[model samples]
Target chain A: MIEIRNLTKRFGSLTAVDDVSFDVGRGEVLGFLGPNGAGKSTTMKMVTGFLAPDGGTIRIGGLDVASDPVEVKRWIGYLPEGAPLYGEMTVRAFLRFIAEIRGLRGAEARRRIDSAIEQVSLGTVLEMPIDTLSKGFKRRVGLAQAILHDPHILILDEPTDGLDPNQKHEVRTLIRGMSAEKVIVLSTHILEEVDAVCTRATIIANGRIVSDGTPEELLRRSRMHNALRLGLVVGDAGSAGVVETLKAVPGVALVEVDAQSGNALEVMLFPAGGVPLAGPAGEAARANGWEVTELHVERGRLDDVFRAITVGEGGASHG
Target chain B: MANVWIIYKRELSAYFGTPIAYVFLAIFVFLSGIFAFYIGNFFEREQADLQAFFQFHPWLYLFLIPALSMRLWAEERRAGTIELLFTLPVTMTEVVLGKFLAAWKFTAIALSLTFPFWITVNYLGDPDNGVILAGYLGSLLMAGAFLAIGSCISALTRNQVIAFVVSGVVCLGFVLSGFPLVLDFVGAVAPPIVVDTVRSFSFLTHFQAISKGVLDAGDVIYFVSLIVFWLFVNAVVIEWRKAG
Candidate 1:
């Protein structure tokens, strides 16, 4: 478990991380969402004991970070932003070096190193220097080192930032597979990653967390929740009865007429009390024998919610 | 201490993993030979005591030790590997000490390559071999003192060229402190006691004693304590400014 309270950091006059606090339990994957300069990397550095918090207390596995930093670091594995590695050493040597730093030696160290290499698919590049690897392979090597000692807590900053699409999927799968045992905290601006791998997400902006919840709950923050857009191609038919038919559907509180697209009638259906209009709207279209051509239900969009919360809409930032 | 050992192994191997170790050793060995024989007139002086060889070490180290120590912390800072190192389960002291010891050992290796000089001196004339050994020891200690100052200065900057120039300038002060040129300047205005104090602070005064085979405990303590003091400052500087 990771516990942080009132975590704050300042770089001269700029308050990078302002009074942030959160708790992470075992078997939880917390995705940190933020825009550029949102303090995600700073928070990770503090939790990993790289940077001391100006005002705060951090405890990893019940040991206070300030008092017992080495012990706290022992319980945590961190992949810093950019995965700063010694480019001179080969991949295998670097892993062995980290293993030694983590107090593993001999057979146990070799065994763990092999498994980590296999886990990240870095076996092929073990003999190659880290500087020679591609961006994707370098990221995997960083991941390999982070998971080498198998610490209880894993803090990764942008784990899949420079990887290709297939490599990103592989990393997502790797993260998901380990989600049941370790307390994983990863920072990224990718919205789909939150839905794909993160069980819970926290949105940070202007050095403060604006929202925290499951993906669905965050999506519900969008203005288009429970709104449905249905287009009909009744063959030269205008908005003769489509708007009325959609409005008459049960659980649909409002129906608005939209502009025609290529001789197709478009009508928007708004559900009552945040109920789903997909079922009722689809049923109405079939029952009225309307040649429905296109239909889309807007449960809400995560990106829209992210922009609204981060752009300081409604003054969401506390500082 | 085990953590320190791990970092030591990594940093030591890191030197050889690049072309830097060979290059530094080649240049250091080549220049020391030229300065000791050609510049210092060792061949014409016909002195078997190696005073000619030992006299130029402080000057030699003013340039060379800074080169060895410049990359000790500056490279890590430039490449951003300092973050990875700090995040490990080790303190700043361990990291500082480890890198220092690695650079010190590398310099020692380059210093030991001058054994042919010792062998040649022994073969040429009846020499005080014990005094010659003591001179080698003194030269190595002076190198450590120079390296410690260089390493501390290296921690203040990320650019290696800046690190090298600043460390060289700082180490030069220690090298010139005990010379008559500086002491005469001190003696002209200050009391004799102040002049002696300033002379006592010089690395040359203590190194000269050990190089002559006096082996006084005070001289040994000066070099060892200088190294310790500078390493402590190195740690503090890193801790205070690293997060920034």
Candidate 2:
């Protein structure tokens, strides 16, 4: 378990992390969602004991971080933002060095090194210098070092930042596989990543956390949650009439034309409060003799919730 | 201590993993020979001692040791590996001591390569082997002092060129502080005691005494304490940089 309270860090006059606090227990994967410079990396640095916080305290497994930093560090594995490694060392030599300092020795060291190599599929490039590897392999090498000791906590910063889609899937599967026992915390701007891997998502903006909950809870906060998209066989000249008719549905509070083509139209009907509008809207459409081509309720769009919460903050969406 | 040893092995191997170790060793041995034989006229002097070879070490180390120690921490910062290192389960003192000791040992290897000079003098004449041994010790201690200064400066910036140039200038200041040209200028503005205090801090004053076969406790203490002081500062500088 990792617990942080009232953490703060300041660079000159700018507050990089401002009284931030959160906790993660065993078997929980917390995804830090934010824009660039939203203090996610800063918070991770403080938790890993790389940077000291100006105020507040961090406790890992019941030991204070500032007082017993090395002990705390022994229980955690960290992959820094860029996954920096010694470029001159061969992959095998580099892993050996890390294993040695992590207090593994003899057969135990060899065993851990072999396991890490196998886990990351690094057997082929063991003799190659890290500087000569591609970006994907370099990242895997970084991951291999972090897991060599099998620490109880894993703090990975943007673990799949530059990976290809297949590699991303592999890494996500790896994280999910490891999430059953370790307290995993990873930060990313990718919304789909949170849904795929994280058990909980925390949205942060401007050095402050805006929301923290499960992916489903945050998705339900979207305005489009439970809203229905109705595709009607109405002519282009009747889009205005279609909107007026759907606006009179019992649970729908708003109706707008989403798309228009000759003799076909797509419109959205937003529910009032938390009610589901599909049943009432469907009955109204049948009574009006309208031909309904397509209709489905949205589970909610995370991107919309993410944008709504972090829009005015700096660099909200580069997409 | 175990942690220090682990770091030390990695750092020492890091030197050999590149062509740096071989290149540095070759240049160091070659340069010492050129300086001692051609410039110091070792053959022309026909001396029974290695005074000519021992004298140029301080000057040679002024440039060479800076080149050696410039990458100690600067390269780690530039490559962003310092974060990886600091986040590991090791203390600051262990890392600093480990890196310094590795560089010092590499210098020791280069110094030991010059044993042929000792062999040549022994084969040619009845040179006092005790004085030559003392010279080697003095040279090693002086090199340690220079390395400590360079290592501390290396921790101050990410640019190795800046670390090299600044360390060279600082070590030059230490070597020249005892000369009359500098003391005379100091004497013009300060009291005699102040000039004497300034003169006592020069690398020349301490190293010259030991090079002449006088293993004074004060000189040995000076070099050891200088190394200790600078390494402590190196740790402090790293912490400050991390915070900044």
Candidate 3:
């Protein structure tokens, strides 16, 4: 588990991370959602003790990072941004160096290194110098180094940055497999990655935590949450006529025309949260004797919420 | 100690991992030979001593040591591996000491590869091996001082070129401090005590005594203390840079 309180860091006059606070517990994959220059990497660096914070305290497993950096480092497996590696070293040699740095030696070191190599599927490139490998392979090699010692926490910055979709899936699966034992914190601008692996998500903007909650909870906060959408097969009279019929239904706060194609009317009805809008709208459409086409309820999407929070909308829905 | 050795082994092996080590050795061997036989006229003098070989060490190290030391911290900073290195469970002092010693030992290995010079001296005449050993010890210690200064300077900038040039200039000053050209300039305005103190700081001043087999404790202490002092400064600079 990791705890950060009012973690403030500034570079010159620019505040890289300002008054950010968050805690990640065991069995949680906390996704740091932010755009570029959002201080995501800076926060990760401070947590890993690579960069000392200008203010605030970070506690890992009850140990203060400033006071006991080496011990705290022993408990962290960090994959820094860009996955910087010793390009001159062969994969096995490079990993052996990390194993030694992590205080493992001999058979145990070999076992862990082999296990890590196998875990990240880096066995094929074990004999090659890291720089000779492709970017994806290099990222995996960096991943292997982070997980080699099996630390209590894993901080991976842009874990799937340059990977193909399949590689991304594999890395997400790997993080999921390790999620049970370690407190995993991975930062990225990829929204789907959060939905795929994060147990809790924190959305950061302008060096501040704008939103923090479970993935589903965040989706529920989206503007599209619970809005009923109806696609009607327009009659002689177009869907402009059915918009009024749907608006007349109870719990329907407002009805607006959505994008229309030939002969079909797409309308979204905003609900006042009093009744089930989808059921009532479907019944009302049947009563109106108009040919109805698509009828569905929106469960909401994270991209909509992300765009909302990042764009400084402050969760302003169609209320 | 274990941390130091771990980093030391890594840093030392890293040098050998590239072609730079071999290139450096080949250049050093070729040049030490040239500077001794051709430049210093070792054959014409034929004094049966390695005076010429040891005489050019300070000059050889002027550019060569900076070449070796330029990448000590600058390359790491440029490649962003400094983040990975700092995140490791090692102190800045340990990293500095480990890297400095690695370069020191590397220069020692380069110095020792001139065993042919020692062997040639032994084969050609009755030479004082003790003086040769003293020369080697002095050269390595002086190399350490140069590496420490280079390491400290390398931490100041992310540009290896700057690191190389600045460190080369500093090492050149350390060597030239005892030269009359430099002494005369300072001797113009300064008193005798100040000028002598400046002269005392030159690598050649202490190296000459050690090369002649005097092995004066003050000269030995000067090189050792210079190495230690610069390494300590190197650590402080790294820490200060990290703070920024």
Flag clash pairs in model 3: none
Deviation from native of the Cα of residue A137 in model 2, angstroms:
1.3
Tens-digit lDDT track of model 2 for A72-117? 9999999998899999999999999999999999999999999999
Expressed as tens digits, the lDDT of each residue in A1-319 for candidate 3 is 7999999999998888899988999999999998687789999999999888999999999999999999999999999999999888999999999999889989999999989998999978899998899999999999998999999999999999999999999999999999998999999888889999999999887788989999889988876778888888766666667777778899998898978777778898878863579788888877777677888888778888988787763233212
RMSD values for the candidates in order, in angstroms, are: 2.2, 2.4, 2.8
Best by DockQ: 1
Model 2 TM-score, 2 decimals: 0.96
lDDT of each candidate versus the true structure: 0.88, 0.92, 0.90
Model 1: per-residue Cα lDDT at residue B162: 97
Tens digits of lDDT, candidate 1, A281-316 = 888778777777778988777888898888873265
**Backbone N/Cα/C clashes per model:** 0, 0, 0
Give the CA lDDT, 0 to 100, for residue A14 in model 1.
88
DockQ of each: 0.84, 0.80, 0.71
lDDT of 2 at B158: 92
Candidate 2 stretches greater than 4 Å from native: A235-237, A279-293, A312-319
Candidates sorted by DockQ, best first? 1, 2, 3
- Reported per model, the fraction of native interface contacts reproduced equals 0.88, 0.86, 0.75
Q: Which stretches of candidate 1 lie over 4 Å from their true place?
A: A229-231, A239-260, A265-270, A287-289, A313-319
**By lDDT, who's the top model here?**
2
| Candidate 3, superposed: residue stretches over 4 Å from native | A274-276, A288-293, A313-319
lDDT of 3 at B5: 95
lDDT of 3 by residue, B37-73 (tens): 9999988988778999999999999999999999999
